[model samples]
Target: MIVAAVPRFRHIVAEVWRPLAALFVWDVAVTIVYYRLPFHAPELPLTLFGTALALFLGFRSNSAYQRWWEGRTLWGAMINASRSLARAARNFLPEPHAHDLKRTIVLRQIAYANALRCQLRRQPVDAQVLRFLSHGEAEPALARTNIANGLVDGTGRRIADAVRAGWLDTIQQTQLESVLVDIANAQGGMERLKNTPLPAQYRFFPTLFTHMFCVLLPIGLVETLGFATPLGSTVAGLMFLAVLRIGDDLVDPFANTVHDVPLSAMCRTIEIDLLQAIGDSAPEPLQPVKGVLW
Candidate 1:
């Protein structure tokens, strides 16, 4: 969600302040131990441990950022797909949909997007989408299938009916169906990410390595650095901890939080834009709160 990096130290302090505080306590313990110890530093292999921890943290953070970036790009594709699908539906015929019929299907598609975003979050379909249904209709539509699956089926049915009514050609129906497939595929891909968690061992490695170095850092610094052992260990330990937690923060793409995929905002944008196309005068744009869109 935050594409551009802000100040690095500020970012780290904000995200991992608790862990940093814990590490500060850790540093105090190490400082006390050093004052009472008989032996410490260079020969204790501090350089090797620090270098290795740094490399691991860098690699882990980069990999997690890549996953987050890829998810964002896919959602960008979904935005474009939503707009294109609406256009295809409205204009595939000789004339665009009349103000009324066009509004219904367009609203339906908007409902579909909102429902799909909510489904990804594992939340109930939002009222924006639910308002389109009565209680009797809602139960059956949502019974077995996921919101995305149901919405796609409804879209297919609408397109098929349009063909039957001689409003859209067979080719136009097929073309419209193809657009739905792309949207369906995007939803499925996000669902797959939700279903398939990051490998436990893969995530564990960086965390384990970072903590391991932090635990060892004070002992290594004790002999040469004395009271400064705490200072050095705290600095190094907090850095590793900060980066490791940052990696963990981005691993899940569909927790529906603002940082995850911006699914709700993107879906709402789809709704507003498509409503505009259908000539709905009541498009209400929802703004992201505190730079986060839920």
Candidate 2:
């Protein structure tokens, strides 16, 4: 994802150049027709169209931003839930074994975060993920269809073992279980956002309207701008299409795009916190490469 401190014009142009090129071509064609064919389309209707298109684009952008915000909030909750679970394990479990088991469970939490991050992005588990899992758990977790679920399962088993060994009483077990349940809820929310997209019509209609607006823009402007119609229309067209593209970028927050929620960075933050909680010197938190945290 792009993390530049200032928005770069070159990057913006690179992303939507094809569509902008089409807009430029359409505008030039309309300008030629206005001068050569002695034909002029009324501009009044174009004004109304632009207004409606603006409203439609606004609604679509808002909806997409909501999805992105929800994804960020869910990850924030996961961070809190993970810390709570580790704190509970450290406080409630009995001695020497407690340290080892707490560390084990914390490491599993880290692995789970990485697994979920990889799953959402449809990427292979990274070495950072394997580093957090025990030798026994790592291979099996990697082999599973849902690696995050496998890690969660291992976490549950570890909780069971703690209870069975009387390291934690039923009340303490229940507390830890509650935190686990919250983690699972956060996971389910993440999966829901990843698996379900905005309605097709929602994505389709706004894009259609934006392009329609771009096509008609030069036609409307040709009579007024004369020779300058092409340049004016291209600039105007770029604005409307840029908003539409921004909405598209935000609609899928897990796609690992520059505009996504920075899942990798978030996962790393959780790892750092959990690792430090267990007295291990955690790796430094990830810094944005350009201006992007991911």
Candidate 3:
């Protein structure tokens, strides 16, 4: 979400000013409290602690990014599945039914995109969803607790109806049904990442570690470089602050931020792609600043 070309230090201050400021105040307080205590390096393992913190945050960032990328890739696969679904319909339906079915399925595929973005962002599916399905279909589609899953189920139901109508051969029905399963799995995976929060322990440790490090760093430097304690503390605080904010920003990639996944833009892309598959001219590409999609 952090796309600005600004220095990371500046970006950190911008994204995490409040927390970093609080850490600064806390650092001063710690320095005062521990002033009476003689500076004892004690072969104090500051470097070891710093290394551990770095590793912990790196691992955390990697895990969070994996979830974000997985969600994006899942939607990419859904786009493919939707197009493939259309192709599969044309393969089996009688000529008259096939064209309508293709539109129906493809339009519904577009609805699925909007519904999913809304679902992920905790927004309601809007009138755009109705652009694809009739009121009878739309009502039931929106009634389910999970709009994304509901739309996915609707796709499967359409295929089932086709099988009942004798439009699709059994093997073809199964093949398309498998696609539905993959779509459902993608939704489930997104939901899993969304609902299952980052481990509380992981978040807690770095936060504690960062604060403790910044709080002690001044003293460690003070013995070697007198009267520069405040400046030294400020520098150490900024470094830890930058690292912490970067980790925090990446921690929840689904959260709405410059850094969060651009689900709305992605859903729009699916809409355009589905329309193209149906022979509609594609709309102009979206323009974004800082190389980021909305």
Candidate 4:
């Protein structure tokens, strides 16, 4: 996500340039028609239209922001649960005897975080995943339809095995299992947000009305503004256009865009923490590039 103190002007312009260009052209055309042609510009209730359009865009923007925030919140929960799982495995499992198992569980947790990140963004299992998982483990897990969920299942089985081997008692097993469940719930929430989108009315009507308002803007102001119609109308129309674009930018928080949640950075955080917990050498945390964390 954009982490700059102030985003560059070019970045802001890039988002809405297409609509801005269209509005400017339409405004100029309307001004020319009013001055050169015999067309009488109809008086429109522009103030009322602008008020209602603002409300529509406001509602859509609120909904989109909520989706974006919820995605971030879910990832936060995932991070916490992963740390808890790693700590539990490290402390609860009998040391020296279950040393390899403890390390395996922690590494698998890191792998699960990266796998979930890839799954949410619809990306393939990459080196990040393979780095944590062994060839035997990765082969079977990658064969499954949902690799993240498969990794969770594999971890659960290993935990169950630890309990059977007397490395962890039933109580300790339940505690670790609860942490896994939290991770699974967080994954489910992210998947739901990625799968289901904002309703059609919310997506369609605000955009339609915003463009319609821009079209009527120049025509409505031509008589009053006269030669300044293009300037006045284009500036007024840009406000609504910019607001409309805000909703589009935030609608999908997992779209792998600059506006999206920084899944790669977040995954890196889990990897660093879990590896450090198990006394393994961990990589540095991901840093933002060009002011975007993703």
Find the candidate with the highest lDDT and give its number: 4
Tens-place lDDT per residue, model 3, 1-294, is 444555445545687678667756765664564566665533456678778777876777777677777767776777777777766765666777667776787777778877876667666675767866887767777888877677778778888888888788789888988877877887777778778877888778878877777766755655554455566667767776776776676655567667777776777777787777667786665656565666
**lDDT for residue 252 in candidate 2, whole number 0-100:** 87
Per-candidate TM equals 0.87, 0.95, 0.84, 0.97
- Say which prediction, candidate 1 or candidate 2, comes out ahead on lDDT: 2
Tens-digit lDDT track for model 2 on 57-125?
999999999999999999999989988987887777777867788888888998888889988998887
Please list all clashing residue pairs in model 3, or write none if there are none. Answer: 1-258, 1-259
**Better by TM-score, candidate 3 or 1:** 1
Worst 10 residues of 2 by lDDT: 126-135
**Candidate 2, position 101, lDDT:** 85
Candidate 4 TM-score, C-alpha based: 0.97
**Candidate 4 lDDT, 1-294, residue by residue in tens:** 999999777877998889888888988898888888898889999999999999989989999999999999999999999999998998998879999999989988888898888888888875667988888877778889998998899999999999899899999989999998899899999999999999999998998899999989998999999989889988888789889988999999999999999999999999899989988898898999999999
CA RMSD for every model? 2.8, 1.6, 3.2, 1.1
lDDT of 1 by residue, 1-294 (tens): 543435345656777778667776877787786567654444567788778778877877787777777777778778888888878867864455443445556766777777777776778774656676555444545664686677668767767877887788888877888888888788777777667767787687877777777777777777667778778778777767877887777777677644587776777788777877756664576665655555
Off by over 4 Å in 1: 3-15, 40-42, 93-101, 126-128, 132-140, 282-284
- In order of lDDT, best first, we have 4, 2, 1, 3
Please report how far candidate 2 places residue 249 from its true position, in Å.
0.3
